[model samples]
Target: MRLRHKPWADQYMKDNNHILIQEPFEQKGCWKQLFDQQERPLHLEVGTGKGQFIAGMGEQHSEVNFVGIERVKSVIVGALKKVKAKETTNTRLAYVDAEDLRDLFVENEIDHIYLNFSDPWPKNRHEKRRLTYPTFLEQYQHILKDEGEITLKTDNLTFFEYSLVSFSKFGMTLQEVNLDLHETGDETNVPTEYEEKFSQKGQPIYRCRASFSK
Candidate 1:
């Protein structure tokens, strides 16, 4: 499933000046600059859609390095365009699969991971494909620091409940589980493309933060 091979994705990639890093899993030390020369920790966003969330986070947290991983080339291009438009030097986008994150990042290298509105994989047969699956959790634990946190937000109730159970099974501590993100109408919560669409339909957004205990 090469995203660049799709017609729409090809145009989007060309329209945006996004340098596609194929097989990021193979380039283990390519992101050394994200941590080198700085004491600030590194943050990663899995399935960054259109880049709004990570770009906003980078703009607010200039001291931290943000890396956005998107499997879809079209989406990655849009995210890179946002980063470029904002002149955000603290952030970078990679066209990489979430399952390969462990291969790309070293152990205890990542400080935080943002899983915003990832694919729910609604079908029972596709449960393993869910971002919150135990297999993926293991990979996340391997890359994240002892105190690293994973912030998950989604509009799907089934996925949210499933993720809660999965986190508990993995011995991860869950915190700040919010069923409705807009209850307080906090301006700090930057909504992503999927979030915007789902929220417009009057759907309640579920959010929770989990941390690895080493």
Candidate 2:
């Protein structure tokens, strides 16, 4: 769902350039320098909506660094605000498209990726636009380390099933598949804004962890 353009979003992005990286391409392989702990593992959240998950993860795991990628300025501004509120040195936001991920990171630069409630792109003609599409997967494979894993969560069963098939066809091994994530009462699960809302209404959340290493 496209967010309504916020008139102040652009200014907010500029004002918080430190937390919201303006020229992410320039950072490339040196993303770790942005954090205090440069040696810590780096994780990327492909579609960090409203920044709830990333903020929670940063607070929970101070030892790891997190970078959130969101193309929409209006959407990312919310994430920037949350991260800024936390005053965390390990979390950063980038206003860039997912398609340009290769331009922002070098090979084997990323340790893990999180895809939370990405657009289903359910129409047959839009299959190629899905995040789990082969082309996107290839981009992910290039930046991710050999043992890196992609963890995904979605409320849409169709998209989840499609992602499972896509991963399998790409020779990626599924390490874990949870048909109903919330049922397990996993305290480690960081709920995004959408996840919390869906779970509140009795919606089943599907989650899976897949890696390129077979």
Candidate 3:
């Protein structure tokens, strides 16, 4: 669902040049250097809505560089506000299109990718649009390390099953498969807006981490 645009979003994106990256393609293959050349592991969150999960992770893991990518300018503005209000140093927000993701980073430049509550693209015809689809996975592979991890969390059953099969078909080894992440009390989670709301209504949350060997 597309979010309603906030009036101040455009202005906020302009004024917050420190946190919002406008031309991410220019930093392809050199994102680490842009983050002060620290060489810390780069972790990316796709579709970072409201920025709660990445912002929290940024605070908890200061050693890791966190980049949250949201295509919608208005949507990413919320995350920008979260990063600013939290006074976090390790996290940055980027306005990026998922289809062009491969162009924004060179091969083996990303260490991890997080997909939280991503749009299911439920219809059979729209399967190609799913984040875990073979096409998207192929794109991610261009940027991720050999053993780089992709963590996913969602409350949708069909999407969960589809993702599990997709990962297996892509030659990825799945780990920490939890059909009920919230009930299982897996403490290492940073909840997204959708996860928190869905879990509160006795809904089951699914989570897993997949890694590619090749």
Candidate 4:
């Protein structure tokens, strides 16, 4: 998508001086090398809006490799800018649809997956489009390692409730389900751009960490 008028478009275009790839799907293996170079577990964040959370995580946990996936080209470009500005070699951003995750990463490859403030798809007919839908969960199950965990954070209560039910139905174990993460006083839990904006309006953020069952 053209990002000419986006708020961060100009800054992104200027900051993306490091290696930025645009291949469709033929470079997954080469991307894997970038992760392997870190010699640590691989983590992925889907729907990285504005790139705050993943960028912070990448800076905080320099030992772990991070891969962020965004369907919107502009947003992906923005994320790449953050990685470049930080001069982070352990993080990579990919422009791909969430549904095509399995084609991008092999089974037992991913250590963790982050779904940060994903689209709720609130309408009944659009439920299937929700990132936490059963089909997408199954796709995550296929690509993630057997013990891989998914960390989900959202400001939509209905979506959070729906996600709990979906995880149960899929036999994934949910832990640390926080209905109000901000009140918990957990310094380690960094808030993303969307999370911060939504919470400032008195919206509660729902968070949970779930892992695939053996």
**Top-lDDT structure, candidate number:** 2
Who is ahead in lDDT, 2 or 4? 2
lDDT of 2 by residue, 69-128 (tens): 988778889899899998888899998975668989999999999999999999999999
RMSD of 3: 1.3
Better of 3 and 4 by lDDT: 3
Off by over 4 Å in 2: none
lDDT of each: 0.80, 0.93, 0.88, 0.80
Sliding window of 10 residues with minimal summed lDDT for model 1: 14-23
Report the CA-based lDDT of candidate 3 relative to the real structure: 0.88
Query: lDDT tens digits, residues 106-195, model 1?
Result: 887788999998889999999999999998998899888898999999999999999999999999998778989978687888788888
lDDT digits (tens) for residues 1-214 of candidate 4: 4565577654565455343545536655445666547568889888876788888898888888888878776677767767777877777776677457877877777889999988889999999989889889988998788878999999999999999999999999997699999988888887898889999999988899999888
Give the TM-score of each candidate: 0.86, 0.96, 0.96, 0.89
Superposing all C-alpha atoms, what RMSD in Å does each candidate have to the true structure?
A: 3.2, 1.3, 1.3, 2.9
| Comparison by lDDT, 1 against 3, better one | 3
Q: What stretches of model 1 exceed 4 Å from their correct place? A: 1-23, 26-30, 34-37
> Would you list the clashing residue pairs of candidate 4?
none
Off by over 4 Å in 4: 1-19
Candidate no. 4 TM-score? 0.89
